[model samples]
Target: MARRERPARVPPRWVVTGAWRVHRAIYRVSGGRVGLWRPKPGRWGTLRLTTTGRRSGQPRSVLLGYYEDGRNLVTMAMNGWGEGEPAWWLNLLANPEAEVEVRGGTRRVRGRAAEGEERERLWARWREIDTQLDELAALRSTRTAVVVLEPL
Candidate 1:
């Protein structure tokens, strides 16, 4: 795993919120061009994830930092160092089918939580790239979900 800059153990809620607003806006405004290229200090390459809302049945989109595992796209449900699972992860659990855009290309994918050894391997990979993994996890009570998106 390549070393990468990591975020603070627990980022301020306002910073997290503000960053997301800016990231999402850039992603949408450029039609998945600008946001995916800028790898921020604590983030890797960004991807635009579109998931079907569990209740609203509407499409919900978010910009996330992600890594690649073979053909799968990997990301954490940390919600920017905040507590609980993010809505995108919850939505994926309800309906695993989703679409993601990376480097200006879109693909259909099915989401699943990595389990046992697979989870361990992936988590270790994250730790290697992100020095703040443990500290970030400590900030939250619940374990973060390691989500994998496999192309369909």
Candidate 2:
């Protein structure tokens, strides 16, 4: 069988981190008018996820890329394709319940890591949107968690 080639390396960590910071800053400066977007055909959308901080017990919000699956929203804890787990994922693990702001409005959600065949299925779905998904995931030492946000 022919082996699939890996995608090019991602941008420097600082670049990736800085981009996210800028995105969040725009969301903040706009007073929630211009950040979140809806998923269009063959592309993922952006949403603002508000997860309670695991240690601080404070509301922590971050913008994430997600796509709708049935009535649920699906995302990956890729952490900018960095090595360690993202804080938002850890916070979700600590407290599964959270809130999300999408293009439509706010919704209360329960988060969980997809596993087994469910995970494989969702991963495949993501791959369709992101052709470099596997290559980016391979940069990390551990498997990225495919997070499913089910409506409460």
Q: Rate the local accuracy (lDDT) of all candidates.
A: 0.86, 0.95
CA-only RMSD, every prediction: 4.5, 2.9
- lDDT per residue as tens, model 1, 1-152: 99877655555789889989987887678865577853444456788899999999999998888888888988999888787789999999999999998885899999999999999998988887787788888888998989999999
TM-score of each: 0.88, 0.94
Report how far off residue 71 is in candidate 2 (Å). 0.8
lDDT of 2 by residue, 16-102 (tens): 999999999999999988878999888999999999999999999999999999999999999999999999999999999999999
Candidate number of the best TM-score: 2
Stretches > 4 Å off in candidate 2: 1-6
TM-score of candidate 2 relative to the true fold: 0.94
Can you give the lDDT of residue 101 in candidate 2? Answer: 97
Clashing pairs in 1: none
Q: Which stretches of candidate 1 lie over 4 Å from their true place?
A: 1-8, 38-43
**Once model 2 is optimally superposed onto the true structure by TM-score, how far is the C-alpha of residue 60 displaced, in angstroms?**
0.6
